[model samples]
Target: MDKGIAKMAFLHLSPPSSSSSFLLNSSIDSIYPKRLFHLSSNQHNRDASLQLPSYSSNQGSRIPAQWRIGVSFFVPFLDRSSEIESLKQQLLDAIAPLDRGADATPEDQQLVDQIASKLEAKNKVKEPLKSNLLNGKWELLYTTSMSVIQSERPKILRPNGKIYQAINLDTLRAQNIETWPFFNQATANLVPLNQRRVAVKFDSFKIAGVIPIKARGSGRGQLEITYLDEELRISRGNQGNLFIVGMVDPFYRVPV
Candidate 1:
């Protein structure tokens, strides 16, 4: 277990120093332990191929703005290789504190041994989650699945330097989205986000019926995509401008 702890220890100490770094430098403060138990929250009540509403930007009618999009792949959780390294660093860092006598007991060493034994034994039993590429349409930044942290929810940081609640793509469509579309009767069906687990296998995707969204007080607005699918490939252009951009493969991020 010291191996696992050691890896995590270093993972916490250092993090990638870029905007794109989402997982590598996860720290104890950000890391959430895995759990076998599942707790269902809100469920999807609608489909992903819903229609979108339209909104205009606050900028004077002449200037153009574009939407900022991001996507990341997701995989199952596992005892990270970094865990061992993290533990080692943690032990080294703790030496100084230990010298200050944080714990003075004969059982401390025994406790460490027990933790190590448990980590080693459990490491063999754990497996990583699995997912598939977005049919080569979307560029993948990075991906790693996490066990649902009981109190944790995904965070979406906006371009304005403000953070907002992150909604699973499916949930965003199901709850906030409203649209009309023609779905492939043979291929597509509205499935429960919780019930579906098959790896993504789409060869192409389309975004249609996009709604414009703006930071509440920023005096700027970009399109908020609403309905998207194989059919009715329509989306709002900047400032509710409508356009049809279709292709062989479309990049998209679907939250699992």
Candidate 2:
């Protein structure tokens, strides 16, 4: 079975946000798509809506050199399934205490450390990530960062709640949607710091049914893509937070 293609078949992209902006790279202008606007809501009694960016069908064909290094390692390692699942379970166990509003015990910290160690050992690519691999929606399964995990609160503590990230590779835009019974979303522009790291500059934040608030000044942070492939992604935030994500339905190709 082609698990890689099977994995891709299960991922999909979310509808682009209406008020989002793109941070395009100069080299790919010829293939870049235009931005589109549509009416949705009025802010402060004035007509307003989000400005969504459009992407072309052929954009994936224009893979840049920096991304090639990462893409070259995209093949799945089916033999490592056991190790992957074990690490994932360990990560969940490590973060469980934090989810309950208690500090992580020494044992829990050790598990987290183990997971990090395994990721670092397995990660072969030491360069910037391929944008195509990061495109589309991802469902957050676990996190080691208490802050982001705690943000889910009682909802995540309960069953049937989760977080989803919608990343638009064509425009370098990303949206993090946390659904814990209710939705809290944050939109940001992704700036590539290098082959392995990207900076996230938050633009707006909003709770379900509330008007989005513009983020003040610059609230930028970095994320290192420790592991990425068709089925899974592992990223570490600048603050040492770890995130484990899986692809969502309706996938696309990762530029080769």
Candidate 3:
């Protein structure tokens, strides 16, 4: 395959606008039709009681002007474009071998270390952690984390196909699905270890729609977030794997 075409194939698997929820639900229906029906029936009663609030045009106007002004000064601002770009480049270099379905070289391992160092430095600066910031869809650009990467194991780290992650803040759960050339799915429970760390316990893993691989013990492992903002996230796994993720179609509730 041509390099450009191969790269594109590896990165995006599904249509740009396809919802992860739709895909997941479809899989659930196929795998456990009876269970899904039962869940839907149970949810109907709950849905009827939970009415959505009506939007009011005057809602914003009700906020006191003085209060709004006072809050503005407390907002945090960070511009790390230069640093982010540097990290992105390093990640690209580190995963180049994998992109071609080749094994990572010693040099690639070195680049991974460099990326980890940069993430650690960024994590040292305290930044507020908000679930809203984490809830949404994200594309897996590059990762050394084995939890996400499964056995079809490219000798080189070429992560071809589309890998997407959907996080539900309300439920404190995360779902990941990949498709096209590679097919895998996993669900995890997100536990906040601290401001900059999270313990992701993998609940299950499924390959090619086969039986789910139930996680043994507490979960798969954990991840230490080094950097998180509107557009990017960098994390390190307990097993020394590095993860670099970028937003898919990020829509922030507040300005970053």
Candidate 4:
């Protein structure tokens, strides 16, 4: 799939609230469908009788006694599976920090679960994935050397002072899917949830951003990156370290 198409589908979440303002009017004839109106209690006065007018094929009037003529509006929320999924993932990310670590207690879990339930209800949740099924790791794609160190922290002033921002794609996927399931589900087939995996097929054709650079502890850094032209995925272990075994010929070079 085209990366642009996939990206758009992957992020479409909620419909605009203003869309509800559109009005629908239909004729009161057999050839034309009559628009149904929901009657509010305030609209009906003490001496008013709710009347509904209907027309036959011959344009004849048919009325029922004490008929209530009002509009009952129902918003059609359809084909939004992908958007919902995206929203679900966002929610997960927000709550992940609170629920992480060995110090987290049952109370934290309970709070997370309760908040999750509320988010699910708001988005009309569908299928839920097991949270702990897969191991999680951050992928070091492209990091800016000019790292933003907090003002309060001590600055390690050295010529080789490099800044690195480690990004966790797996965590991003999990967070977006968990929080905004509605949005993601709507666009799943367009982008595909499986595509979320950092597989070579997607990496070679998709990722957009800066080049991937590496900094070794020895103070020597290799800036081998193929940005814009294509994306690359580094094989990783549980600790987020790159796993390189066997012959290092074409694999050692920057991604094509």
Candidate 5:
């Protein structure tokens, strides 16, 4: 059961990583195990012999026998999964020095945007609003908004803990939460605007996870999910800000 930040933007060191570059690398490693490349020499020789020339769709040209050196040979180079993981690392490295974009300069933002655009172009979940990948507890990795990070506030008032946003596409609900120092949170309902967009209508807010206040008209806004996968998600807020988060829990649910 959780209630969170319905309309706030995100900022800060966030995920202890590029929200954790180390953790990101580890995740990629887990997805692609070494056993994939553990083909024995004997096995390679057998595979080489067994592979035959593959003809083109028109049957006018033939594929070299060497082109069929088993899936392992092509995994490191052509597997979309591996390619996605590689892009994730590149993105992590780009933001690892930005402090979840709290310290990002104009030039830094541009660089991050370039990389993010590439990921969005190859989004695995084309229609994120309807995919299970959209339902999860996503830890903020980088964002373009300053409000969520509270940079204008005196350091004392700035959140000293992590921020999280969770969603349940099935229920058309969402929440955002802060940890420690301030537990400010909010809850909202999601109205579908398109295949990848939603109009968010905030219903309530809780101060320090205790008090409750009903939402007003200002609580409403739009968000478009541009890119999504098993571990990463990229979103755009109504104000033209960009948000990048890494998935932590797929089964995350909002309290009904």
Candidate 6:
């Protein structure tokens, strides 16, 4: 069951290092065991896609500037790029402390989804399958797939190193790797579903980066590239898990 879900979704860009402290506080909570962060409060956040309206009250409550949700909320003249960048930072910060979502709650997942959906709405890349940006070694940042995180197992028993996925659209090949503990990996041939989606059909698995096993005929799944750019890529799995991975090595090649 763990191995089955591990193959769900994969891709992303590095999160911006600097985010508004207030924004981070509003969207995420303090970290707990297993690298889990509880969702204490998210009142300030409104859907980033919607034009957030100002609220007035007899009590005169104040909304943080980050959550104001208007032209002033972002740069002028509908420059969505800046807005997208801001939300992107927020998304990264929200998950940075969650340790690849080993223990993310449903609320935490919802927050990630809400922000990701907003970014998907303004995806800069119209056709991710053909984009050069899609070719690289992407560091797994956050995922709703617990199989990759191995949340049910103890941290010492789980792969404690960086998770990565590399692809070469030129060859129509994709590969996923875990860096430490066990360098478990898998390779797949991509069958394009459209300009923005593909079916990941596994060809082989590398146990600890060595022993190879032929993939079963059933080892295939649907993955849709929902958002993409030179620095970032967002995707969804057939199991409905969201994936965010940061580009780590643009020059990484899928081993032949």
Worst window of 10 by summed lDDT in candidate 3: 19-28
Looking at candidate 2, the ten consecutive residues that score lowest on lDDT are: 20-29
Evaluated against the true structure, the overall lDDT of model 5 is: 0.62
Give the per-residue lDDT of model 5 (tens digit) for 1-256.
Answer: 0011225333122222112100000012245232112122122111211223444566533545666575336544455655565666667767766656677899999999999998888786878888987886777777777656654556566665666778887788888777767666667788998999877777776666676767766666677888887767888876777888866666778876
Query: How many clashes show up per model?
Result: 27, 16, 10, 43, 5, 2
Can you give the TM-score per candidate against the true fold? 0.15, 0.56, 0.54, 0.19, 0.72, 0.72
Clashes of 1: 27
Error of 4 at 165 (Å): 14
The clash number for model 2 is 16
Candidate 4 deviates by what RMSD?
Answer: 22.0
lDDT at residue 116 of model 4 (Cα atoms): 43
For each candidate, the alpha-carbon lDDT, in order, equals 0.20, 0.49, 0.47, 0.21, 0.62, 0.65
* Deviating ranges (above 4 Å) for candidate 6: 2-5, 8-78
Model 5 C-alpha RMSD to native: 10.5
Name the runs in model 2 displaced over 4 angstroms: 1-104, 124-128, 151-160, 250-256
Best by lDDT: 6
* Model 3 C-alpha lDDT versus the unseen true structure: 0.47
lDDT of 3 by residue, 1-256 (tens): 1212111112112223322211120012343232211111113112211222342559746768987665444332223444554554454445544532134455765766677577557653364245455656666655543324432344343334556666665676766666664465666666777876655655665655354666545333455557665555665555555566656544322111
| Reference-based lDDT, residue 46, model 3 | 20
- The per-residue C-alpha lDDT of model 4 at residue 139 equals 17
Per-residue lDDT of model 6, residues 1-256, tens digit only:
3223344343211113311000000011221122212222232233333343443673224655565565454545355755886787678667766777876888989999999999899887899998998987777778887655666667776667777788889998888776676666778788898998787777777666676767777666777889876556788876677788766667779976
